[model samples]
Target: MDDYTWRIKMHQRRRRVRRERFAVLMLVVLSICGAIWYFGLYARTPEYAAKKLEQALEEKDIETFRKYAALELVLSDAYDDLTVDLFHNDTSLTPQAKSLFEKFYVLIKPQLVGATEDVICKRVSGGMWVMPEGGDMLKGRQLGIDYEEFLERSLLRSTRIKSLGEVTKENGSASIILEVLEENSHTPFTLELGMEKNDEGDWQVVSIKNYRTYLETVSPRIHQEVTEYVQATAGIVAKYNEILQSKQWDATYMSYSATGQLTKEQRTGLANYLENSVIPIVKKRQEELNQIPVPRGAMYLSNLRKESTDLSIRVWQHYVHGLRDDNIAEFNTAESLLKQMLATEQRIEDIIHRAAVSKAIPNMP
Candidate 1:
């Protein structure tokens, strides 16, 4: 080969060598990724199984959970936590997990499998509730058992789980989403859970991440009892307004429910609740409203009515009768009366807010 030919041949050889190096590099990267996806993602350690078991526990899905848990974990913790719940007569658990599970079963299990399950199912298909671990989220550390009460109240409260789909797993750690339907607000709230396994091979929930759960209210057809309440409450409030204006104390007292009627025993409690709870707060809010000049325009009556309707629906949700019934007749009566009172409360609050806004703008019709 001549000098030119030699240069050209050398260039070609260099290009081929570079290409081969690049190919090898790509192969290495792909192999590493495949390993992570397989062992880290698909492989199940006792920890991963335990986490799934915990999710099953929160869901109260005993049958499905039974399959996910290890035999030892099931015999030890699972048995106690699921079978002997207050509502469940499974009788297959030790008294401790069973007794503790009772509180959870009474409060949350129904939402997972019973009638409430339908409501949740409609919200998220293949619906599963992922609860956030409670504590400092940065390190994903859990609170100690001694602080159980504080953990329960504080961890569950003030959490901000927006959607259940945000949960994912990394390494051996699983990120969970805690979904809860608030009774008073009638809204679905979510929070993130960070969990890991302890030395004992038992899974411990660590912390709640991004704790920013906010109010999410929805509008739908309410129960019939709630509708009845809206009408009855409006009527009762109209009557009460007339009674207050006409100074019919006796008749007003008679119209009040037993709790509100100021029975000899209840008078003190009512006075304390009204004085300490309602008036001071409303008056303070009114004072604040007085300082801030009302806006030039008022929210339309239709808009106000819509807001009131939504609020009424939310308040009335508490009257929902669940799976257990001591007596159907009693449930119906209590539910009806409760819904009516809630509707009245909604209407009264609506009127109060509108009145305040109206007074802010004297020309508002």
Candidate 2:
């Protein structure tokens, strides 16, 4: 081929290669955009959630409104110290009444996980998820700060959102400024609704900055209460753990009040362990194990289970007297043997018949 012809062919090939690379680049960009859209990242942004929340409240769409609210995060726990002091220790009640209250306080502390904020949210949501069935005493009472009041000040029907700033995003978290005005209020408060990317990689509202300004609108005492409530939520779970640890497990078990108070701390099977009377039986077995010459951390049935079945049985017979825990706590020996008997009834009957060749078949247990 001539030199000019060869140059022309080379130029055509280079142009073709450039076009192919550009096509691949465009395809990659489109794929990324599609994935972002598919994950609903656009729909789950803080700005989008805020706007939807505002509209939901305005339209009285309680169901939709709940999706945007952090019910778990804001709610008080019935088991909190403040609540125990308030409802469980009233001075004027009769003895029977006080006893009943005490029983209820003990019963529901762990059972009723969410408290005032959850209660109010449920009411607002028309019982989308109600409180603990026996939480009548907490009715109509806001534990510390009324989340409703916060909503009223921050996002109520009469509240006007003055501005929504561009979302400030960091790695997997974001915040956006909002200026809002409450009904008949001259001051427009500035706040920031913070957001986080959930496990599903969707943005969710996690915090509201300077939102405590709403608490300031109330009385000083009310402000203090709200502040305390917020602070309590931050550390209350750990506080509960501490309180539980502070309890003398040995005394509670020995006094036969562990179940009436709380289930055995280290229960494996849920049902067998939670019953009121059964915990004492389990504790008695544990007490027997405690009397043994075993070293630290070797008292419980869990450690026993890790040993060979023969070892477990030997240890139980040596340390524990009645083997009640072998049946109820560690594993249900009676139930399992009965099941095995039923499963091998034919074989068992045949063996019995052979054994009874010299005597009549024994009556079935």
Candidate 3:
């Protein structure tokens, strides 16, 4: 053990210390890398994305909702299912007609998709969903039924997540099963959502796997609701008709002739007859109709009836005033109002008849 041997031993000890330090540094680096992967990359899993989407929907955060939801793609997929159910359930349509409707749907799909997307965005942004006035335009008259309402009732309404099933992940893609209860129906249904990782590494919902099945499951409940609404509306309309019949309205209307040229005395008689008889009865009928409770589905019919009855009162009043003052302008106004009232009445009858023919109302006339 001389000076050279001691120096060699010191050098070996120094080397061993350096090696130990290097190993400790590597361990620290690996721990940091593992933490980053777990907290950052692993946290952004498919289930995490689905939870974010659920929270966004609950909060009505449209921007965040859009970040995770491929709305256009999902809706496009849903549209096919929707049309299939629509044409399938429509008993009035022949096979040829259904084929024509599918073609028409294809032609208008882009516009419909845009419009429906806008509606969903608006609903999410507004915090509450309500069909705006004249929104029935979304329900095409060519369909001859309320398809938009059916969609609204089935999908657009508020829903509560009942349970979330296992998330299955594939090659950069995944799926999750969600059980939800629709607020309006309180019926629970299952939805399988297809998700994929985007370029940004965030997972997004691409499509609904079981949308058609969901629609089929909910159709009977929705149809039952519609039937109940139609039946309730029919009862109210029947009561209105009964009132009209009891009043002997047709005979009363035909009793007076305002068309021919008349003496001043005859004009006075016509004015008195309308003011004393027609005006009061029309006003009373309007009041009675207004007092009746209108079902939500019958709002259109109720509004139309209200307009007609209001016009009927106004028409008789104008007729009485025209005869009393010999004012031609009042007579013209009365004629215009009469025409409008008649047209409104015709529309009411048409709707009732259509509902009856659809068998929405039993013994509807």
Candidate 4:
């Protein structure tokens, strides 16, 4: 072979060797990344979950609480109950588990609904009043509630404490319990709380059982408030009626509560419904009333299925999804559909002067 030819062949061989080395190096890098993800990142699920639960509890995030709570965490209403269960109960709770539960409760201190914030935060923030911590007589005085003022506040809010207790520790397990005192309702309702421990020995609540709360009941004050709200709605209802009678689709559409409470899609749903179902039935009814106009009263009617709330919620969800995806058309479609449904069932009987007349308008039927 010629010298020049041999040199060329050697050069080609070196290039091929370098290429093979480059490929091998790339493979090694990828393998290292995969290992790091599988072993280092993926393996910390429990720790991450525990941290998240703790942070959420501290932040008083109810949504996070619901998400994190599984089926085993104990929750209760009263601090006394929790302490009794923790200290006196025959169960032996792991230190880690106890700490987690304590911290979680601290996080939700303010939102104990009717409970005084001082009771929850004071005990936890400062040392226990008479706890038997080893070698340390921890005498810490935090905020104490002025029972009278607290009671007054509770009365004004129309909510009061029901029950508060923790699960007696039994065989290394404990539960939290809170009995909610409802207003003008059940005497003592109970909420069962549960928590799970993480790798770091932190107890994170995973579930709530019998989570009864006083928020469901409306106080007499609230009832009065509702009455006032209805009275306020009278003007809006009148405008709604007039807009319907005139069959001014755009005007009716514009009258919808399309602000922050109702999304763009929700407003569109009203518009579409007005154009289709609402206009037809309303027009027919108006023509009939015109032919034989009754002086007794103006009877407005609308049909609302039991699932109105559910459908509205679903449309809102769709709207949210569309917003996330930046799909304006899809969002508007959902809104339009919802609006049409609302309009179909919307009717108003406007006895302009006799607004006080109470007439039973069939809604679902």
Best-performing candidate as measured by lDDT:
3
lDDT of 2 by residue, 266-316 (tens): 332233223333334434443443343431111112233223223323332
Per-residue CA lDDT of candidate 3, range 60-81, in tens?
8999899888899988998888
- Predicted model with the maximum TM-score: 3
TM-score of each: 0.27, 0.32, 0.60, 0.25
Worst 10 residues of 2 by lDDT: 294-303
lDDT of 4: 0.43
Candidate 4: segments with Cα more than 4 A from true spot: 1-52, 56-68, 71-172, 175-192, 196-206, 218-224, 248-365
Sorting all predicted structures by TM-score, with the top scorer first, yields 3, 2, 1, 4
Question: Which is better, 1 or 4, measured by lDDT?
Answer: 4
Off by over 4 Å in 3: 1-35, 38-40, 130-154, 158-165, 170-172, 232-235, 242-365
Model 4 TM-score is 0.25
Error of 4 at 351 (Å): 23
CA displacement after TM-score superposition, residue 113 of candidate 3 (Å): 1.2
Candidates 1 and 4 compared: the better one by TM-score is 1
lDDT string, candidate 1, 1-365, tens digits: 89999999999999999999999999999999989975776444544554565566566665545454233332233223322322132234566865675665445433222322232233233445333323422111122111211122222232233334444668977766667654322445565556566565444445444332221111111112223333434554465356434433543443366554335434444334434443343344334333432221121222333443444333223222211222356446646555644544554454333233221211112
Rank candidates by lDDT, best first. Answer: 3, 2, 4, 1
Whole-model lDDT values for every prediction: 0.40, 0.45, 0.71, 0.43
* CA shift of 49, model 1, Å: 12
- Count of backbone collisions in candidate 4: 34
